[model samples]
Target chain A: MDKDKFFSNDPRFKVAKKEAWIGVGLVLFNFVWWFAFAYGLGSKSPDEYTYILGFPSWFFYSCIGSLIVMSILVIVVVKYFFKDVPFEEEVQDIQNQSDKKSS
Target chain B: MQEYFLGSRSMGGFILAMTMMATYGSASSFIGGPGIAYSTGLGWVLLSMAQLPAGYFVLMVLGKKFAIVSRRYEAITLNDFLKSRYESQWVGILAAISIIIFLFSSIAAQWVGGARLLESLFNITYPIALTIFAFSVMIYVIIGGFRAVALTDTILGSIMFFGTLILLVAVIIAGGGVTNIMEKLIAIDPGLVMPFGADGNLSASYVSSYWILVGVGVVGLPQIAVRAMSHKNSKSMHHAIIISTVFVGIIMLGMHLIGVFARAINPSIAVADSVMPTITMEVLPPFLAGIVLAAPMAAIMSTVNALLIMVSSAVVKDIYLSYFNPQAPDQKVRSISYLVTAILGVIVYLMALSPPDFLIWLNLFSFGGLEAAFIWPVVLGLYWKRGNKYGAISSMIVGVTSYILFHQFYPNAFGMHTVVLPILLSLVTFVIISIVTEKKELLQAVHK
Candidate 1:
């Protein structure tokens, strides 16, 4: 359990950590935001059954409208912010180096 | 085919998108989900949209990190990643068992869906239909493997995409436009036109929880997660996100809308699940109806094959090869893998012979059970470096046990779905156990 060696101010781990938080943060934000807009805005009124595009107002915005918004948002997020982190090769390199040192 | 079954790990954007949609869209989406919507009304359509972002969540959350990490480990299955990451046989074995156990319900749901579809379409007896579907899927899966599954899914996905459009148009025409359909529905019950269902049965709290269950919690499903390990690059993931999102949006809204509309046309349907095939046959010409019918067949076959492969891979690769015979030859592993998959299919077919009430419930139960069991271990194990095997095993145990208990004794506990409580409980258990074990392991490492 040489935990320190793996975690000790390792530049790769640092970058990986930052990337993870940003990714998780963005996903969580979208999950909450989407549900709010889908249900909160769409189903605000209980008694009335409003219609949009011949659909119940809540359904029109919550599903069809929200789906269009979601598609665009997902593409934008992936394009601009997401990075390709090479976790495999980096982890393997460290393991190889350790094996050599131990021998 | 070998690469296809075992993943070539070099799929392009279009193939990746098609495969993801095909695998995710199942008998439930095509037959069972639409059936439920027909009876439940427009409220169910709104709830089904929670699945619109499913592909996005799985691809993005797991993303390049999971693919790269898996390549580094040369891991194939979700349980393979678990075994390597946690460095424990117990964790690996538990994961394999969980996948096999939970996936049965999913596979059986597909079988029943396929049989029901066939029974209606061919006008055959239920037993004959069941046997036909069972044998066809079993033989095709055994022969085609994962490559067969992916190729078929690509074809099936395209059918569903076009089938949805054609059916929606045909159905709208049959019902004398959406306006007339609305009039008929309003005539039956003004409540049918409401957002909260015909009787206001759909609650705000319940709707919100479905967003968690089908939307966010999809990241935990092994069959879906395994797709993360197969793409060529980040570009494929991005493409998958856009294509699948759009396709799912249309398929869900279109199919379910067709369901709600079916009531206005034929309100006296004896069985709700038959509504889809019935409407298709009635609206489209006989020649075209056959093509449209293939979409559900495709959906059922694709879903069952994916589940079968995942279950078999979990058994052969994770447990048998890893434990009993680490040095078993490749040919032997392949043979046993095929055998295990066939046996699983037959078992599910038997279960579907006397189909129980609420077939989709079995599928949803599988979804929640898998989400609870694997969500914490997979997500935290990747993100939180402090996570270890003890935490992984304990998290799985608590997650699975609580989900089952809650499902049986206290479903929709506190108005939210059973999954919400178990996922939160497992998250707490994983972190606490990890922190407590970290120091002791550190001390032991120092002693060593």
Candidate 2:
């Protein structure tokens, strides 16, 4: 079905293509976020005794701070970006299908 | 509960959030993980954050599709989804076998963790502790079923939240300050303060692989994925995701940090798993210790209850009814479920009799097994229409076999965790086999 969608203009196909991309984008964001926090900020040791918010500078940003930041970030993305995806189909599609069945 | 496995599927946002959080935050999250952090230093704390995106992945990848499709088929267990999608009895059985084997190992580990927590808190022998926990969990699950389990998660989730918060504050005060603790850590070993971990052992490859182990691969865990199919609507799903994410974030960071700080208070703690209890007792009075102790006890009990229910449902709903007696009376099904739950509890209790001095391996094995076996099937089966029974069955067999082989012979292959290789191999198997068999399925359809 997706193979022919390239040449098709159905609105449902467009929603699906967009939805798939959104899913991929969300996954990629999570991957990069974890790598940067766990390996990037944490890759170095500075002054051997540097402290931030009672955590080692790297630990504070990467582990503790990142957790709090991610909590808010996920909530925001889910609220504003990710659409409500009902798998069965749109409510209108269901009503139309039921009418066809009865007819 | 209208459905034995999924409850009424009318869960509110709060109950949905609590059940997801409680199930995801297992005994290892409370006890074994922190114990590892106590020795591994601040690096493990950062590594633990890899789990922050766990609930995110389950809700996102499986999301609305799983719930709606499961409803369309009236499926209950995770294996029920497999049976319906692939149209194969083999797929269902293989899924059931994987859940029982891996989750049983997981259950035994949790029982050990619960018993250990009790031994430390109440000063009792190990077997006595095990008996008390086993009966308490079995009785609760037997009496209330899934609704009782979800409601208990609400109470347990609160205990986890305030419990960790209180312990974190007390630990910080006892260590003088976070700054003071950092200095004390550096004094003991300069490596302890670094991101690379104590002795610079947490390699870049090692830490990055955790992204698969705890982050994305969590979508494969049946216990967590089943929660995706139980919400009342999209709004409830959305709310559950946000709330569970916040709860997981706070507990993982706070508890692991307390593990690291335990070093500052008592530098010579003998066993790492004992770090949480020792520090909680050292920092707070006995009464508060009891309260905070409930955090881990609740963590373990809630996790065990969820696992017991899942394994029982797998045996009863997925295997027995699907194969032997599809038309079995409801009363028979009810009796069988109760009997299976009790038998499973007894088996796990016996396994935990002489707990391993270190239990990370048993728990990790279970995690890896489930991921290697189920991750590709669940994810690809849902999205890729071409995926077939050959693909599903082959993926399961190849996955569990390679996982065990790699685990026994070649762990941390090329400095990466053993699970990475099996998940990759199984995925390659799934896609290639699926494409190969796609033509046959299409041909049969055209002939008809």
Candidate 3:
């Protein structure tokens, strides 16, 4: 296969490259937001208490935040990020061979 | 002749074993082990039990498909597999960068954990300890690659397993058995021995969220995910599953329980992290202590080595080879791989010197970051038909951004981990975009 054929010619490659740019955006945003939170809010004071079922409020918040983020991630992955694209004829042929072997 | 560069014969069984051992080992078994025991009393042992199934779960869940897909694509790294399967450079690069960033922090934390372990064991300075630990790991990683790592990991895993058993027995014997220790812990502050943590600090939400971080979300982790890709075949996969689960479970339970039990043996201990080292030294003879202490070192080194290899591969294979020097020869790639791996290790060593107060949190922080970054990209990229470039990009952007924002400002915003929000936001972004920009041709190809 030619160089371009390996990457540029492949539709999947085109889409993946585009997605990577998006990932870059995400990382950039994360960096900015995290720095702001850390600097703006300062470190959490251990002496203070945020209660949830008799636990500190910070701990409770962390748990809730984790759940919300993960739920959203799952939905996005299942619904959008995981879309199927048509396989090239050559690639399909390879898949067929592999399937035959597995069976 | 295409001499299989990815899986070379140079990587024999011993090296492969070591690599596996090293990859699976982490600071959790060292600093967190004793820390948990020191605070929770004996109940930490029960908590450790949860880890036993970890290895088994990964192997079983991802089993056949993982190995087959990786092999078919000639994927040496987790990012490579994702790139091929999704046919997306963005997925590959995102996976690579995320691995680099998160593993950098994770590796640094391991270095710190190793240095701390050394400092506590010997009267050495933290920097010196850090240097020695970092150099040792970097050398083996650069020279041996995956094979060496696997071999070392097997040895380390064995040490961890037996070491936990030996220490557990010794602590029990010294503390006057389980019943006596429980009584002492109850007297000290009944909460210490409870399922929650010392001071009744561990909340239901926090503990459950741990399932995502250490449990299910583990699927997204490159260090672990790569394992799913490396096995020889289905039978090997099955064997690894059984072996890994039992081993992880025993070690996790044993180490954590030992952590909690140490409190009964040494209630006056101030720094929680020091509990394990102190208890081991106190319980066992000096010679035995020396031997047992190797277990933690083994754990730290193994984890460090794995992270080093992984991050290095992310840089060399996914980013460098795929993007910068796509036409570079094999020899050039090999040289770059070795050089980059060493450089990365050194940088992490520097980062590790200062060390964190709660080392477990540092490790978990990296874990959370990686999961948020890669979970949707890898999983949805595999199963979804509508997953488009727009959707994948949006999901990643949302997942990572929200994760960072929550982690910073409203960490545990809703009593959940920071990762939860970002993952959800990214998912919504992924679906909406894919549906809106649904391309008939792309959808048909991906669906078939």
TM-score of chain B of each: 0.97, 0.97, 0.91
lDDT of 2 by residue, B296-315 (tens): 88888788888888999999
Docking class of 3: incorrect
- Looking at model 2 chain B, report the run of 10 residues with the lowest lDDT sum: B1-10
Candidate 1 chain B: 10-residue stretch with minimal lDDT: B1-10
What TM-scores do the predictions have? 0.91, 0.92, 0.77
Q: What is the TM-score (0 to 1) of candidate 2?
A: 0.92
Ten contiguous residues with the weakest lDDT in model 3 chain B: B1-10
Q: Give lDDT tens digits, candidate 2, residues A32-90.
A: 76567656655565464456776666666666666767777778877886555454436
**DockQ computed for model 1 against the true two-chain complex using alpha carbons:** 0.29
Model 1, B186-242: lDDT tens per residue? 788765665567787777788668877888788899998888888887667677777
Task: Give the clashing pairs for model 1.
Answer: none
Looking at the true structure's interface, with contacts defined as alpha carbon pairs within 8 Å between chains A and B, what fraction does model 2 recover? 0.49
Arrange candidates, best DockQ first.
2, 1, 3
> Candidate 3: misplaced stretches above 4 Å?
A1-103, B1-22, B42-53, B439-448
Better of 2 and 3 by DockQ: 2
- List the DockQ of the predictions in order: 0.29, 0.36, 0.03
Query: lDDT of all the models against the reference?
Result: 0.80, 0.80, 0.64
Candidate 1 lDDT: 0.80
Q: Count clashes in each candidate, considering only residues at least 3 apart in sequence or on different chains.
A: 0, 0, 74
